[model samples]
Target: MILETRGIGKRFGSVLALRDVSMGVRAGEVTCVLGDNGAGKSTLIKILAGVHQHDAGTLLVDGREVRLTGPRDALDRGIATVYQDLAMIPLMSVWRNFFLGSEPRKGLAFDVARARRVAREELKAMGIDIRDVDQPVGTLSGGERQSVAIARAVHFGARVLILDEPTSALGVKQAGVVLRYIARARDRGLGVVFITHNPHHAYPVGDRFLLLNRGAGMGEYGKADITPQELTSLMSGGAELEELAHELRRE
Candidate 1:
């Protein structure tokens, strides 16, 4: 396993955000974390991304216990998270956005040429083809922007990629494009943690599923262990859904 969380948990004042949520991601596999709103998915991602520390649990990198105090800590350990907002400046060029905080420098000066060359090469390595690295980030399509973010994370040497609701706002075609890049990332031998509520989106690319309900674990199952229909039904609260159907039945 590249990343492992043992009995991970978190709390906020009177509410319990997570409990005994254990998960693991290995190279060349996508672990999809599925849940609806307030299901503690965000909290769990924060923990894994080093945005928040687990109140209780063990975070292990390469099977060795480690503490993630902040985002830098996680990044140093080869973990990178791409949130829904993507963190790219609209007016900035693609290469600049790619190296925003960690820009390549030449003797205390920003190496604009080097950054552009490296960015183009890195994106090409991920099979992403954008017309120009000099174009402003806002000029790229939504799917393209998402792909750039993924490529940036991969280029930065992130052994584990944590994506939060990456496909939520995209159209079917755009979502399909992003999913392709996700598969590409997995193929590159990186552990991928894909978080989303859409069963359709998760089903196609996920190797393992960790279902969350009201801040608790429903269960973890391999792709071969459960059907997509079963996963969707369970995610929608099967018994509760049955009750709801009966309640809404016309006489």
Candidate 2:
């Protein structure tokens, strides 16, 4: 396993954000974290990404206990997170944004030629097609932007890619595009932690499903053990969904 949490818990003042959450992400597999708003999904990912420290339980990286000091610490350990907003400059060129902070250096200056070539080659290697590397990132579609972010993460030696709601703002076709890239990433042997509220999106590409409600785990299930319908019900709170369904039924 690349990343695992055992009985992890976190609290903010009087509120408990997460409690007894346990999950593992393995190489070449997609571990999908499913939950609605305020389900402790964000808190969990933040802990994984090294943005927040867990107040309780153990966090293991490659079977070794480790405490992350910050995001840089997480990156040093090969855990990179691509958030929903993507953290890319919209007006910058695609290649520039790809190598935003970690540009190759030639002498005392940034190596523009090397950066552009490497960026283009990496994107193509990941099956991402871009007509021009000079085009502004804002010009690309949402899925394309997400693809770029994923490609960037892979190129930077990320062993565990934690994607935060990548398809949340995308349309059907655009979301499909991102999902294909996610599958490609998984096939290439990187452990992926896919966070999403939509079970439909997660069900297609996920190997394992972890459902959360309020601030605790509903359960974790393998693909063979849970159908898409069942996963959806679990994410929405099965009883709550049943009550809503009954309310909508005619008298």
Best candidate, lDDT? 2
Q: Once superposed on the true structure, which residue ranges of model 2 sit more than 4 Å away at CA?
A: 241-251
Find the 10 residues in a row with the least total lDDT in model 1.
242-251
Worst 10 residues of 2 by lDDT: 232-241
Q: For each candidate in the order shown, give its overall lDDT on alpha carbons.
A: 0.94, 0.95
Instruction: Give lDDT tens digits, candidate 2, residues 122-219.
Output: 99999999989999999999999999999999999999999999999999999999999999999999999999999999999999988888889877
Model 1, which residues run further than 4 Å from truth? 243-251
User: Model 1: which residue pairs collide?
Assistant: none
Q: Candidate 2, TM-score vs. the true structure?
A: 0.96
Q: For candidate 1, lDDT tens digit of each residue in 81-154?
A: 99999999989999999999998989999998899999999999999999999999999999999999999999
**lDDT, residue 187, model 2:** 96
| Candidate 1: residue 72 Cα off by (Å) | 0.2
lDDT of 2 at 136: 99
